[model samples]
Target: MASEGLHAPRERLTEKTLNLHHAIVSLTEELDAVDWYRQRADDCDDAQLKAILLHNMREEMEHAVMVLEWLRRNDTDFAGMLKEYLYTEGDIAHHED
Candidate 1:
């Protein structure tokens, strides 16, 4: 006989894991944009604009860390987190106006 009680929790865990993966992908894209903008901000001579950009970039970093924490909680691999950072750096070089 099947222990029906185990199935519901297992299903819920699977769903949660899928949701975490989705969040990770979406956050990675945002991190890319943040990198592009940060370089532009650094190049700007205006202090006010630089401050704003720096604030936004810091926020993006914070967000990435939050998503990473969520992924870690769910046993998601951390192997690619640094890869994402490196990719964002490359993006800064290629996409800067």
Candidate 2:
């Protein structure tokens, strides 16, 4: 079956590209879920439900991070960028220039 949000014909894509597509799509969905849960938590009046929503949002963030790690592992460019940009104390934008 064809994957969602594919910009080109599936037949034209290699297996590696397809797998990356899947990971990117999954990352997008997880990030979106995190946003949604955050909004819901903010709007919630019930403390317990708000806590649940916030907890779910954190889980979604974890999922997004895992997908990012997968991308870093599978793609050299991503690995390089992550190494350059992640966990550094100095100005981040300076690295881009």
Candidate 3:
């Protein structure tokens, strides 16, 4: 006996797409968390806390840029991503350390 549907080729393309989507979502969540920390840093009076928060915010923006590039290459909405990136960067920079 020969396998019919059992031997059907797996949907590797779909799997990869799902994995990419998951990655983007995770990165977005991380960016949001970083933004929150940045906002918290604004309220912090301690210089050390402000410095750490600013550093983390910078790192998060870098990650966001990387993800945005990936999304652009993947034929995502580049304009929207660019707009969001700019907005987030501005928000992160609002408080000077």
**Top model by lDDT, which number?**
2
Among all windows of 10 consecutive residues in model 3, the one with the lowest summed lDDT is: 1-10
Q: Sort by TM-score, best first: what order?
A: 2, 3, 1
lDDT of candidate 3 over 1-97, digit per residue (tens) = 2212223354544665655665577577778978887998998999999999989888888887777677666645665656556546445544344
lDDT score for residue 87 of model 2? 92
**Every candidate's lDDT:** 0.68, 0.94, 0.69
Candidate numbers sorted by lDDT from highest down:
2, 3, 1
- What local lDDT does model 2 show for residue 57? 100
Model 2 deviation from the true structure expressed as Cα RMSD, one decimal place: 1.3
TM-score of each: 0.56, 0.92, 0.57
Among the numbered candidates, top TM-score falls to: 2
**Pairs with steric clashes in candidate 2:** none
Q: List candidate 2 stretches off by more than 4 Å.
A: none
- lDDT, candidate 3, equals 0.69
lDDT of 2 by residue, 1-97 (tens): 6677888988999998999999999999999999999999999999999999999999999999999999999999899989988998878878677
Q: Candidate 1: TM-score? A: 0.56
Off by over 4 Å in 1: 1-17, 76-97
Look at candidate 3 and tell me the lDDT of residue 85.
Answer: 62
